[model samples]
Target: MSGFNTSGVLSVAPARMLVPILLILMWYLGRLHSQYEPIVTSKVSSRLEEARKMIPSVKLDWPIPLAKDPRAAFNSSKLALLIEARPLPHLPPLILHMMAVIPPDWRFLFIGSNESIIGVSRAYSIKHQQVIGKLDLVELPPPWSIASKEDVFRLLTDSRFYDEFLTDVEWILKYEHDSILCANSETSVDDGLGWDWTGAARMGDGHFSGYGGLSLRRVSVIKRVLSFQARFNDSEPEDEWFGKRLWVLPGAKVASRFDDAIAVEDVYMERPMGYHIREGGGSLDKSVWGDAARRKEIFEYCPELSMIMDMKLERQRCPDDDGNGDREMADVQVTTAVLGEGDDAKALPNDAESAVLPPQPPPLPQPWKVSVTTFGSPLRTGID
Candidate 1:
């Protein structure tokens, strides 16, 4: 009995010691779990934060910026002036094309009548150009008319016109709606800026043959001439008036003949910077634009000329056409080729008095008509 009692006491003591050891083990395990739980939770939280950072958030109040003004990149002194009272359909395109071909440092101004101004400003491209400060549209008041060629001449010759409208302008590129710059031209418009006046050369060797249809003029030289001489009203055209004085004006670097011409008018050049088709080719010079081969070459070099010049399709050529772009009137066969029912198909005038009839006037030349919509969008004129 005593042995059994001692064994029981030893077993009980060992069991009691095991309970405390188990408790210690459990406390150690709980402490380790508590330390690792925060680490695991932090690792998960950090991963979630990194994932959230990968996605972008939207801000409702962000504002979009407008396109930068293009005129800031250009020289304010160089101005392109177009004065047209006629609401020509080609004005917007002609202006835009010129803007593209001319140096970017030049600004454009259109001083036009209400009809013409409205016609031009209706174009979306023209609106964009205005928004960017590259162009301006103005309607001249009374006593500053451009209704006729005489009126335009008077306006340009007047010194007050320049003082009022063109102050601070050093160079002026005067272009008509019928004129256009050739994109394929090897000579840039900037090269012509060196001369005081450069334009299409006239037919003869007259001094200062800078025809002003698509001409570049120096304002200082023009001001000098205007200071001393006033153009006689209803006299020669403004270009000629300026040319006559400009030739005699001291130290003016004017284009004298074809050698210095920047544009083609009556004379022909290999690759002129631009072309001035007078009255949309109704008054085209036979020397420059008459030859079939030369016309073909010009068209190939500058296909854009077709947009401004009056042109006929190849199939529209008259049956008796001459290769030189003219028809030999005497050689034309006006007689009916079809024979009558019998052999009495002799050539005859329809009326007995037809032989004595007065000569009829030639048909009016057709203008090259283009819709403003056809030019597609305005050229992307953003400077890189």
Candidate 2:
């Protein structure tokens, strides 16, 4: 001891340095692994669980009448189907046929303008099935007649409306169960050709066109997107607004099963779908089958649609849009703008391959001086 073992001290010094270095390397590796981990992580799962817990204990399998009469046997187990529409009467018979094909368990929740068209849709919905309950219609306020753009912004951004929208969202989320499924009247159906609707980019020099249809799972995702929209309240175009918001949410997936080759054209940049439909003065009737001739034309020109349909049916899986990856807002904006708009207003290609059309200007409001009947509430009547 008195000799002060310097050799031992020197040996111990290297061990002390090596221990800290090894600890640092281990810490760095742990961080790296976490950074590159898959998005469906424990954190995301926990968030979903928390969100679910926050919702009320509402029963999804509410009993509903099966046949046309409510007095008839309430045999169905499913509760509701949410369909977004504008002028509902114009909905195609094909859409009605598809709805009829659904198992007799679900009821329809039609969101659209409170017009006679809704009444027609309601009649159609209950024609084959029972009218368990009157359709719940959530009317969107018109954006055009506001005093100023700031007023429009205020309406969208107001926390009160945001809270209301959130309540509507939570109500829908509570109903999200295996028994409930959503279907839209409008989708890009393949015409039994060989055109791949799920392609990522367009092929020609003209405007790029793509499909905008989604699966049942996407309905819940859309609710989450609306919640985010309420939270952020950015005033972009509707579909673009919806797409951008979806891109930013954690683990949100998009349905991109449209022909990719035609959608990459530069002309599609300025226009986008939902923009024109919402802005352009047209009824849902005109929107649905308005371009039937065009669809036939495309099938004649590109007979590959029939082949594509067969492939799509065989695959028969929901599109892993956005590549099942965490998509960025920029990606959403870029993709939506490119895919939504076509070459020109009417020039926008319409076929059995693509459901989305380019943005159009909003309709001009009816003159305020005109005499009008005030049904229910003035605020609600004017907005529609």
Candidate 3:
């Protein structure tokens, strides 16, 4: 019995060895998959962190390669005003009054209903033929039979609109038809940036709040938003469409109250730059805001424009008569060559809206020729 037991004891050695061997194999396979995780994971984490610092908006899934700011194409062409024109008899005055405060050189795009009564006007210095103030009007069909809510999208996603009008335009200042700039609103605050680098925390829903009806938008932000149009139902409220798309847009942002995008809700701040003259409450009734003192409170916000309205009222702004004369001038066609993105040129249809001027550029031609940097990594200029 002792002899039999000694032989069997040797068999136990293989079983003991098998247990340790299996453990070693399992550990080896796991390490094969994750051996580089610490190093790779750290690299990925740092890149993601950098992207966050660069774009503090919604977090991106992956790091964006550093490149020339698409915004740089805007160059000096920043801060375009997109005024929504309600079909009111006073709209021309309102547009003129708002344009008075705006610098003559800055871009202004007025969007109105298809049957809108907006007139074409140009302001020029009498001393020189050079045009001073100008406004471009674009009219589109209402998304709803009567509602103006969805009109912004027609401009937002329509390639022809961008090609013909907004290619060089950046920083859209959207004012609902009834909203008007108040007296104390600061025009200097709009440096055309839609981001806050200072990290001052906002109290409310940030830009997801539809720029609160009077907000400035970065051109680059909206172009990115255009790609997501299909995901949304156009029939829905335009603000809801923008909110859902903008919420998910990785690097898109609009300036906030601190930047003077607006601060109507700020109890700490006494006044907002503008007020919406809604039908029920804040209607654009002349009796309420007709006085020089009252209107001055609304227009006096900008020193440069202190007497601009007075100047406009004193004398009419008449651009030089067309060579074809006033009557024929009605049919006088103006065209501009589409620049920058080639897609824009091709996207423009044969219709008059997108056509370049018949033979010459308009009275004041802003030829927007932007050169994109594609080959090399650009120097890291701080996102201004």
Candidate 4:
């Protein structure tokens, strides 16, 4: 009887010990799972919310003229400013400066990444009706919203946002403006980096083809280009695409001329009247060049005539009371000299030397006016 009791007690003792050990193991696992699950859930939810916020609520009033038509509510005489912004700190002031350069009849359309910036832009548009038109703000979807982390990471680093922005630009052109003047608000030019008016003139005449800084055109072209629902690859740069298209369009013309004395290199140069600061820290050349070595090669090959001309023109136009007729016949002379001499290209200054380009002329005492005319029946049906 004593032996039986001892064996039973020993078995019971082991069973009690095993039960607690198993329970503890289960508790530890449950606690770990609970802790990690919430973290994963929160992270995913945050990303989703961010993605949702990035999509702009699009409101389109259609039947708007896609071509330059006299009967259209918006006229061809007006200019359309298409600005691509991406959460840069300096954009508001840049927009203000742009407003100062163009005619009051011009309209401003901004496309970019952040909704906050768009909100600020809309406010500016309302306050400066004489200078701004219907503000079409298009937000890019966040990078992480995609199923693949690789795609999300690629989008975060790549020009996918800019490419999408271009699509928005095409849409706006088809529905709103008669044409678009795609300009960079982020680049500042010096004698070494300004406009190549000669190149521009030559290109304008039909030899080479390009568009940068400020390009002007009509809406009919945009509609035709986008009708196929063609999507630009993220690898493709926006300016190059625009340049190629503008070069082929019939009746497309440039309103500004470049000259040397005007120091088109200066942001304050009277000719450009307004200047763009190449915001978002990436090189336009590098973005388009594809390879670092190739980019360097092209940068070395090209004379920085465009930058020089831009500064000179800005200097010439800055002092004009009205934004119109700031061009001087000397512009052609300067351009001819720069292109012919080749010496001027060598004379172009470095970034440090160019930094001395004069300050902007005193802010126009009055805010520049931007006026917009909206036409067409408002679209109430299925829209993207």
Top model by TM-score, which number? 1
Better of 2 and 3 by TM-score: 3
Off by over 4 Å in 3: 1-76, 82-86, 113-115, 118-133, 139-148, 157-160, 186-189, 192-209, 229-231, 255-268, 280-384
- Minimum summed lDDT over a 10-residue window in model 2 is located at 173-182
Candidate 3 lDDT by residue in tens digits, 267-330: 1223455544344233333443444555565445533233222233422323433321221233
Best by lDDT: 1
Worst 10 residues of 3 by lDDT: 123-132
lDDT of 1: 0.84
Could you tell me the TM-score of candidate 4? 0.31
lDDT of 1 by residue, 204-279 (tens): 7657758958999999999899898988888999998888888888799999978798888888889888888888
lDDT of 2 by residue, 57-120 (tens): 9768878646565523422222233333334333333234334534343333433445633554
Runs of candidate 1 with Cα error greater than 4 angstroms are: 1-73, 328-384
Tens-place lDDT digits, model 4, residues 172-286: 2111111111233122222212322211221232332222343333334544444443434454444344445544555543224333211111122222322222322132222
lDDT value, residue 284 of candidate 1: 82
Model 4 error, position 108 (Å):
1.8
Residue-level error in angstroms, candidate 2, position 70: 7.6
Q: On a 0 to 100 scale, what is the lDDT of residue 355 in model 2?
A: 31
Total clashing pairs for each candidate = 0, 26, 9, 50
Better of 1 and 2 by TM-score: 1
Predictions: Cα RMSD each:
18.2, 33.9, 27.8, 29.9
